[model samples]
Target: MIAAGEVIERPASVVKELVENALDAGATEISVEIRGGGVEQIRVADNGYGIPHDEVELAFQRFATSKLSDASDLDAIPTLGFRGEALPSIASVARLSVVTRHADDDSGTRLEITEGRIVDRQRQGASPGTAMTVRQLFRNVPARRKFLRTTATETSHIQNMVTRYALAYPEVRFALDTGNSSLLTPGSGSLREAIAAIHGLNVAENMLDISVVDERSGQSTVGGVISQPALSRANRGYMSFFVNRRWVQSRMLGYALEQAYHGFLKERRYPLAVVNITIDYDQVDVNVHPSKTEVRFRSGDRVFSAIQQAVRQTLTAHSPVPEIRRAGATHPAYSPASRQPSRYFWPIEPFQPSPAPNAERTGELIPNEQDAASPTSNGDGGFTHKETLPVLRVLGQVQSTYIAAEGPDGMYLIDQHAAHERVLFEQIKADAATSAPQSQSLLEPLTIELNPRQQELAHAHQHLFSSLGLLIEPFGGDVYILRGVPSILVEVDPVRAFIDMLDEMAQGGDVESWSDRAAYSLACHAAIRAGKVLTHGEMTALTRQLEQCQQPHTCPHGRPTIIHLSGSLLEREFGRR
Candidate 1:
């Protein structure tokens, strides 16, 4: 019973061990069903090589496995279940029953275990597969049963485990039915199809096809659908990776993805990807983790560099910035006079001398009339005699999304929206941290009705809205009334923004801190969209503002807001002098 706790902590652990056993048995299709947090009942059915009638009773014995014959097999362990402790451990803590029929035999076998002891065995009529049922889990161990979390939390963990396997084996059909009637059915074949089925077809449609082969390794292959930079999510949970058809987490793989998207995404934002890597079996250790969710490579550094190079080269070749244009169907050329001053001009405006002290200055509100009357500099060296920073020259907009500019050192490509969002995010975060956000009253209050789930989320995060300068009050039922909004986002629709924020929060899975994410979401929405046309001054000012940022190269979402193409890279691409 003590050993059972180590192998199966909760319902999710039981599912993971059972699925691994099925995979080892060569099952092409697997189904899992759980009721009451897998305490009342848990069933795993798999179409695989079944056990013989005689071996049925022995299957639950500790350290007994058909995978390995001798001690030398330990050095070359390939199957998922070699230790053979999972079955024994699980059987020890629950009422366990296994019914199986081998293809070589006509009849099937049924075996039952009660508290780790084989209680019954009989030949029976059953399908040519294996079906195991675990009921009253931890019933023999009262201490373990008492530690289980709520049914909903346990079910969520089980669902997450099922999803990991579904992603790992795209060729296999997988289905998961939770107790609450929430079903996840991933029906058979092709990684792309599986991804589309699970993550939505719209996401798959926008994916950038990526492939790379290494001739030296003698195992070159293609897999992974890179998302367009514009189709990013709020969290990294969407990124899925597999190695040799097994879903495993590799830090090296994540680093490769980051490098590939160095110049494309914003800081703190992660792209949606399904990267599959194929390598020689001997080069990887799949037995690193008990759950088999993590793996280690013999030469991980080399693999990391190769994957990064392949993705970077592919993106650079296929995706390029489009040319910028002005509004009203006009082809505006880049010129010095058309450029505008930067957004940071207000902080560095001219300072005026204060007037002589009067009776009003003593414990009274004295207005700075002289400072108000003084003319302020625009930071472009155009209006006043104050020294200004050097301005970057605007070249054009790339793919109508990134702005290309030339500075004293080198040329840069800037993602206008990401840069602007970062600027606004920093400003808003600082303001909210120091003082209450400035609120702009709306002429008419906007009412928003939410679903039960969204309503719960909004109620839970009411304090987040307060910090962002929004006065949202519950108006009975699942409706909320918005009386004011952040002054910086005055142009935005309050009701729509509030709903979007709620949806984004919900989609993020589990947000530990609501205020931080809310601030980021607000800043992101208030920033410019991808298709907006910027004036010459706006472009110049944007460049200046980006340069002033602490980490100007990347946005807050982890995407590179700018990419510098050196003369060497340009010459190589164009074959020019």
Candidate 2:
């Protein structure tokens, strides 16, 4: 009973399992009808190979799955919801009714199950397919039903799941009805069409195509559509990833995607993408979760690297700048695509909703090898901007924090702290690669107290400490005296910064990641802070130095240093043509 509860937790889970059964049965068209946020009723009808009357009872039995044969089949199971637990589990908590007929059969069989027991069974005349209606979900388990969110939120989740599946399978037609809202997806077998129907025309046109193949495994292919960095969300909820056409949420893949846009996007900003990954069925394990939303890959590192490289290359090839959209523009009231040079963009078409708008690695989580070897250029580091930053005419400072400058195409507002941080981070990285970093001897030694663990950590990584230009002497049990500090970091709190870096490394991280943490900490502390006044030459010099660095777009912590307000946007805001 508990296991069944886990498989059919909410109305969405029930909908997911029933839909998967339909897909597994080779359904070309599927329709989902939900009422009361799917709590009162959920009807899933699929025009697929219907169930045979003789096997109708067995279908509701726990562990009864038609996809798997033996234990070995578990390694490479392709079908979703193979637990066979979905049916009986769902029937146990809801009022369920199913009517199915095979093409070869003369009639269909109707089975009414209330609270898991067969209340009635009879032969009925019906077309070839299966329609399962579940009502009063969680009726027997009031606790589970009570935990469900309001009708609107639960319905949103249901809509998103259906759209995700629609995007995953463009060839399969899907219809979702939630009374007031009807979503119909054209099963015309075009991914672009499906995306437009589900996400809207703006999103479809804004996305870039991605295709990458691993030479190590000729069978592996990663391809799909990725939204421009500009079209980002505050969360990862909008992103969709799939393995063998089954949508799965994976940290490894999500990290790869985020890391690919390290500098292009600010912290907390997540890009929207519909990424499809295809690999040998034997390489991935989909049985990790009962909901089948998580999966395990044999070579997670390889997959990670493949995805990161593909996204990095695509972004590098084209910019994500949006075209100037006016107030009278279509439904979105804005445009997502731009006329960038040589960009692989899908042409936008007028969007129309049908009956059902079906809308919708790698290794050690490391950066590219070339990025580590390259001494200059943030492009090598997988940052979006590659070429040198454009020169700007200084227009003085704002609120004693932001440096306002005029560029050829747009006006630029630079965050003093972030700009300086990026400048220092690149310089630090370059110095670390060349030789020992420069240090300044303090006239008055600074002392800092630490816990026993921190002291031990400080002592353990003394070599790395010296490499970053910190001359420390152990004072006592939990005290350390800093006699010298990195030259650029002297103005900041050197002792506290050094301790924080040690704490970060002690927390647990790989050597490569530890290096990033060290660099980020040093740059963060050393960089000029906001509210600092600067002369015209100082601001101009800062801007020029920023241009010379590799990733001038953002600081080490992924904060944008500059925001360009286009002249056209200003004109539009001012009501000028």
Candidate 3:
């Protein structure tokens, strides 16, 4: 029992093993149910080949498995379980029950084991599948049971585990019930459809399809959906990887993904991706960990390099060049006067004299406000502007997707929408820190309907919205009235923004603290999008503003706002002589 306690720490661990067993059995569908965070009870049902009545008793013996015949079979371990410790170990520490039937048998056997002993066995009519139940986990080991976390925490871990398998095997249907009313059902279908069902629909919509095939290795095929740069996150938790239908964690694979995005993403920002790699099974080892979550590849470096190169090539080929927005000369009312380059001639005519001293002072002796506001030219003849606040320079838009610009001392590239989000984030944060935000009253109050869950979150965060200059109140049922909004968002549709914010926040998880990330996401959604044109002066002003920021290189969300390349580096690139 003690040995089992060490191996099967908690209910989530039990779920992991059982689910793996189902996968190894070639199950096309799996369902899991847990009560009290899986501590009180756990049930795993799968439509897979079941054990024979004769073999039912042997299935709970330690070190016994049908996956291998001898030691030689260890060289190629393709299944999720081979040591056969899962069932026996779990049975030793908990009340374990198994109901299974073989295809040839008309009836099945039910076996119950407790405290490392088979308590009972009976023959019963059952379906052609397997259903395992575990109860009172770690009951004998009170010390270990005490270490278990809250029900919510344990349930979250189970949810994450289920999500991984759902991503790895889109062809397999999966269902999970957490004893609470919460349920997750990802029906069998296409990878995209599965992803949409598991994650939210917005994530699926933003995913970019990426595929790479290597001709030399017949072992190479990488395909997945990657999030656009604008939709990046602060962590890599959302990224999922599967190799040959098996989910395994490989640091090398993660590094390869980062390398592939070398010049594309900003620092500290990770791409959301779900990639599946197909390689020769013989070249991989899936028996490295007891949990079977880690993998080892023969010549891992070689595989890593190949995957990185393939993804890099694909991204480079698809990268689009930004378009330059030219200023229109027809809009005389809004356009600045164009000036021609000054020409120098021998014995230039004497400078024209002014009728009054004041006129002469303004023309030559005095500096105008416009000239004073402009940055001073440095010794290298480059303008060196500085500012006191963070600024976002308007760079040209590429494929109407990305924005590029030059900041105070570095080159700035922004997802136009992301940049605007940073600006809006600052504004919201400032308002939040002070008293309630100053709301701009709307002539007509806007009403919005929300789901039960959304309404709950909205009511809970009413104070937070009030601080962000939003005036909202319950209008009975799952509807709310928006009587006002932040002055900056006067032009925006208040009802739509409110609903979208609620959805984004819910998807992002609980956010009760002041430093919650949902605030940043909300700001981003309200910010400007890519492809918006700006004048040269506006771009220059943005550069000066960005220079004033403490961390000028990165925005609030940890995405780099600038990339610096020295003048000397540019010369070297061109082989300047």
Candidate 4:
């Protein structure tokens, strides 16, 4: 039982071990069927070279293996299962049965074990393969059984496990049946086909292929498919990485992939990718953990640089400009193939939603009283220009996204979203400097349902949430109630804003403090979007507030808030000098 704890932490762990064993046996076709969230039953059948009749019972013994022989062999271990503990450890906790026939044998053998004791062994008719069945898993250990999550969550973990292995080995046919759901991947040996099978065809079409080899040694190679900037998910769960054909969770690889899309993707959005790095067996150590999901590389820096460069190269070569997809819209507003470089872009109506009725204006620049009184009587409106900023006259808005103004020397174009983000960030910092940031109460509280993992994270980081003016209280199992939010996020949807904040908090491992992360997330969410239409008064107020910010040149995320076109440059272009 103690040994089983190390190899089988949950139902997914059992599936991983069994499938890995099947792959090691050179299985071309594998099938996995489970019931009762894999706790009541799990059957793994593989068309691989099975054991002989005499070795059927020996395969159940601890530390008995055909993969490795001596201590020296550990240096270059090639097979996935080398310790020989998976079969015995699993049998020790469940009722297990196995039927197999070696390629040389005419018939097969059947063996049964209950709680680590062999009970039955006999001859049976079977094909040249192996089929293992486990029932009532962890029945002997009630303590471990109680630690499992809900059935849905457990099933999700198992499905993710299967999909990951299917990506690593595209030539192997794999099928999974959970009695309620099913997934199958053809052994077509095409990564694109595999991606289309798992994710939809539309997503597969947008993925870009990438391959790069280490020029220094030519021993390490990185290859995979990464999604275009237009296709993105809200989280990083879609990324799957493998080392030497073994699925592993690596921080360095993930970081490299993310860095490649640094400016292309917005904050909190991640691209889907399947990255595989093939290297010499001796260069990596796979014996670091019992699960073998992590490895140590001797030349991690070289591998990291290789992955980053490969992804960047692919994106630069095949990436298309991002397009906006609207409801009931048959096609994107712009087509890449028909696009041509020009001084002006195709005009499209900016997105403008009706303002709420009788809603108190929040996140607007300048006070309500000062908004009515204009400092300068411009033809457009009573413009409120500040002294600290460049003396400018509000000319008009361009593309409903940039605020065009006339400066003393030339013209200035300001990105509305970036400028708002800068203003909100400074305001939040100032509020937090004095007290526990400001919060506004909602007319009606909202209840949010979270998954098991999210619930655990919310509970663990309750203090951080409260510090950011989000008053979240436990409503019931896997549910939280929101009574108020940071003042800046009042106009945003309470549910989405809260959930996005929680997701940001979950990925705060690299952040120095939880407060700073929460603050940044709120500011980004509360800032004005790019396509929003602003009235003359609103634009004037926004520009006024931006002028007073401590750091108005760049947003909190380091994006330029404004662009300056010098008068000399414009004159030279027109030959007016």
TM-score of each: 0.56, 0.75, 0.57, 0.61
Q: Any idea what lDDT model 4 has?
A: 0.76
Query: What Cα-based lDDT does every candidate model obtain?
Result: 0.68, 0.76, 0.66, 0.76
Model 4 C-alpha lDDT per residue in residues 236-321, reported as the tens digit of each score: 89999999889998888898888777545667879999999988889998888889899999999888888988997776555543
* Reference-based TM-score, model 1: 0.56
Q: Residue 459 deviation, candidate 2, in Å? A: 2.6
By TM-score: ranked, best first:
2, 4, 3, 1
Question: Which candidate has the top score in TM-score?
Answer: 2
Off by over 4 Å in 1: 1-5, 182-186, 216-218, 317-577
**Per-residue lDDT of 491 in model 3:** 55
- Give the least accurate 10-residue stretch of model 2, judged by summed lDDT: 354-363
Q: Once all C-alphas are superposed, what RMSD does model 3 give against the true structure?
A: 20.2
Residue 463, model 1: lDDT of 72
